[model samples]
Target chain A: MIRSAAGLPARAVEPVANLWFTWRYVENNLGDITTALSQHVTLTVQAVVLALVVALPLAVLAHRRPRLAGPVLGASGVLYTVPALALFAMIYPLLWDPRTTVLIGLVMYALLVLVRNVLVGLQGVDRGVVDAARGTGIGPTRLLLTVELPLAIPSIFAGLRLATVSTVALVTIGIIVGYGGLGQLLYRGFNSQYRAEIATATVLTLLVALVADLLLMALGRALTPWARGGR
Target chain B: MRDDDVLGAAIRWLNDPLVWQGPGGVLARTVEHLGMAGAAVLLAAAVALPLGVWLGHQGRGGAWLIPLTNTSLALPTLALLMIFASSGLGFGNRPTIIALAVFAAPPILANAWTAVREVDRSVREAARGMGMSSARSLARVELPLALPLVAAGLRTAAVQVVASVSLAAFVGGGGLGRFLVDGFGTRRYGQVLAAAVLIALLCVLVEAVLALGQRLLTPVPLRTGRGAVARS
Candidate 1:
């Protein structure tokens, strides 16, 4: 007989297939599952938004100064190299809340991609576009806003999409801090050798990543009607 | 809580003579970690290298695979390890290696595929004009030129495997993750930090070696600012 969480004996005879997925377990655990999912989405959104806020000014500054670009890109590469678990472990002792620690780690991981993409996109603004704007008596600020930034939107969106999906996947690593969202289920499932939890958690994490990527793609499409027409 | 005290405790843990001995020592764990990570990367390269190269030489169909591979680069490491280890594969290294190898393959495959295709058209034309067979042209002419990117992809895969091998601890596989899992389980925060430090250093070491290798692989002509500059 298998023991339940309450230490009661469960029926010894059960269908082997039931171990793979059980609708009853999910139906009863809706509250925990939903809570995990919401926390995951919340964590991913906050991290990406914060990363963009930080990456934007730095990207612009680097784009303006070629000398600064190398160091900026180099630093991001190093940051990205810091593995998720190691990053979390290093940060865990310094921070009080698990969520905040994870948030900081996720932001640092994303900074490299976001800054690199933004810099590339901005630099790619056709030199003729800037020259034409200047010839029409546009100020530098107006030139950047009207001509350069809009053109960079496609590349910027690409970075955001990547960052969002990766963060969704990486959020699972935050289980060390008890904040790994659906990763809680995965970890627990492993401890108990519960097939349904492991399978469901894995499938759900993929779904979350896929859904986030699709949403970002739709947002990008809506933002850039011109990208579609040009192709 | 005093952060300095935790740091001090971690320093103590790092220097402990006992922690450096026996089946569970830091040095042993590091070696285990490196061995497993290396195996995973090599395994991935074996499968991905041929497929990626073949698809790249074909030149048309595998365009779709790039995005698919990039997405797979974020394969949920923790979850996959658990699933594999539990799937009648028996506990420990077998399952962990399979999962880690799967995680490591995409970057290599994508890189090999893209690098082959990116070799200049004129270079291929020259190889053709020399009466080189398709196999010979791909082997002798295209691959050497594509070495820089292949090296880059290998470096990415290797570093990534080193970085994530700590997860093997979760599956009863002995490695540096042993320290992490044990420390966290026992609430020994200092040990956890010490393990983190060890892992980060390992990552840095792997990255340095790969960077040197990539430089050596890159021909003098292709060394023209592609890697150093952050251009798209």
Candidate 2:
């Protein structure tokens, strides 16, 4: 009976056979998957790094000028609250170029967390520490680098962690515009009705997030040994 | 018939009923969206809070839960919605609830867990030394102290759920997301902007309510610059 089932006409078996075939195809295309993942990582990292570069200064500027913090942070929060897909859609026209969309979207999302964290981290620096730094004759540049940065590490790390997680997750939205990422796999899996592909991509994305979280936690621990020492 | 014509056409498109109808339709949709989000939050709290408290009080192997929650928090809500929709599950409210529930769970779980764990150790010790039963001490002491943090988590989850439930409209689930999705398909910029603006307003409103609730529930002493502090 089993043999006869396998021996049945090709059309009779194509659905079940194709399912396995698609699974194998995905397995064999591991290189494509890796490339997709690398693209995702690059997009998330570059966007986050650029956002930090921009946000850190803006945060400092706002800190120095308290009135600006409200508008700057509020605007970034509004941008952050825009749904990932909607944000991508809204920006698509101005760009009119697919290649730039991923960068644009990622950077926008990064600004949401990076800007908030920069402000929070900066503000969180103990007031006494800033006064002490000033009393020590440190200039603004040296003060930010030496005292503010170190003291703000905990909040900064928290923001980076939140930003990293958000970036990794939302980079999948890039697939909507033909940008490569794990989201592409997820989209394709759904569009093609391939359950195995969907499960595999979902699981793999979760693993990537887990790994990233662990790595960040480790970095946080290393940077703030006091936190780990239960102080 | 150059730039002004284009601009006029755009403004006219924005005024069209198809573009502007959802907000007027919001009263009906907001009920559905709120119902879904509210139920998910309630469900998540019921399950996650107790487990978090137990794990925290046990003080053994609780570290594992935090990472697990953090990892789960990273799951992309939209992708999950798409994947679930394609499984022939019949796209609509049910799938939206499940996705939003899953999205909201991690924050609730992590916050509850952290809040319980962070309760002043001296307080716990004093309770225990006074011959209080484990369950009693947890109910009377740890839970009260943890309420503010847990509330903070709920607030985060609420904001996330509100934003995420909008994605349900993408798959024909019919909420505020419907307006945004329709706006996208038709390129009605005003409708899209209006939908987005409304969603943001909804988020802020919900956040404000939750903040107020948090303030009310917290004891006055804890409410003052201490309890409900934003998590680092």
Candidate 3:
């Protein structure tokens, strides 16, 4: 078997190199990592934020009309079931730019998870609480805003957490489309047989996901103080 | 670039008899994709089912297990696949299977764990009152009740593995994804479109089959209960 520079067999030519040594290579490519990380973060944040915007109205509509919930969820579920790599490839030709395709694909994937969570959160509000408020003549808009919305924050944040972590991971796959955060390193490193670069990229990508997850968890906790102990 | 042009070309490519008759044909690639994905799901189920069930029955370890599994969602499958491929695993099917198995395990584990744990404690107690041992109670009462959720987890893992295995082509593994890679490399837009369609159809099929299986596996009583309605 041909061996890579790291003395690893090059049978697949895509193996991860040694970690300590990979650190040196990673240091040398800090600038590239930074660029990719920024791009990755930008795409992830943008897709998720956009998904939240689009999903909220849909979720509200579904919540208001219980029957609409099934079709709304089913449509998003169909999108979610589409293979990520295939979806990106299918949309790539139409969009021309990898970034746009990645953005669209990520947004589509997030919609189902986010919308479902929002619906769950809204539906989870106790009927007794709603009835009590109604008995006091609380207006619909005020009730939805001050009571229901706050109650739903926890579930919505849970969805955000799930969406963010998965999106970060998915962004790495975007390397196939010519865009990825640390994913660029994995692909380039694979082609060049640089195991260290692959290791560095993989580690950083994981770290980014970890951090995003933790941040969202904290945000969820802060947003729903009542749920802190329960969580 | 027109939509109709791409659609027409893809349909033509898919219908061409020559595309299904050879070693690298769509038939072969579809089987390859199924084999790789199926192996991963099988592997994940093997590890996750027993562990999740045991933990759930014991009512222990969930505090840590759930979080750990949740955190694993952040691990990139491609990165994991590459690492396995480069580590002298000879890439393609072996390493790809291993990585895909790892990718597919979390959902099954988490779902199964939750499913068994969520089985009605009253049901378990009633079984025990009838002189059933702990193991017997779990097997007779809990397992039956938990089967639906366990099946749901299996369905989740199966769909995920099938969809993600497209990357196997990039890593020296045989699969329908090869068409996408090869097509993109050679600028054969038809092949790319065809591959995308096949992968999507494959995922949808797996989902439908599993949904049926889940429905069938559920106990009749459970199937008609509030729990089933809530889950659906």
Best by lDDT: 1
Candidate 1, DockQ score (0 to 1): 0.68
Chain A (alone) TM-scores for all candidate structures: 0.91, 0.86, 0.88
**Deviating ranges (above 4 Å) for candidate 1:** A1-18, B1-4, B225-232
- Provide the RMSD of all predictions against the true structure, rounded to 1 decimal: 3.4, 5.0, 5.3
- Which residue ranges in model 3 land beyond 4 Å of their true spot? A1-21, A132-138, A225-228, B1-4, B225-232
Once fitted onto the true fold, the runs of candidate 2 whose alpha carbons sit more than 4 angstroms away are: A1-23, A27-39, A63-80, A93-102, A119-138, A145-158, A175-180, A203-231, B1-24, B87-89, B125-132, B225-228
Q: Just chain B of model 2: what TM-score?
A: 0.86
DockQ, structure candidate 3: 0.66
Best-to-worst order by DockQ is 1, 3, 2
Best-first order by TM-score = 1, 3, 2
The local lDDT score (0 to 100) that residue B88 gets in candidate 1 is: 93
lDDT of 3 by residue, B1-232 (tens): 3354776788899899999879999898888889988999999899988999999998987767667777778888899888888888986899999999997888788888888999888988899999999999988889888888888888888888999889987787889889998887777777788888888988888888877788888877668632242221
Global lDDT scores for all candidate models:
0.85, 0.74, 0.84
TM-score of chain A of 1: 0.91
Residue-wise C-alpha lDDT for candidate 2, range A1-231, written one tens digit per residue: 344566864454543632413558676779878887888778877887888888788888988899998788667655555567656654655565555777887887777787788788888888987998899898999998888877777777787888888788888776545674887887777667776666667776777776776787788779886677652
Winner on DockQ between 2 and 3 is 3
Residue-by-residue lDDT tens digits, candidate 1, A57-77: 999999889999989988787
Question: The CA-based lDDT of model 1 is what?
Answer: 0.85
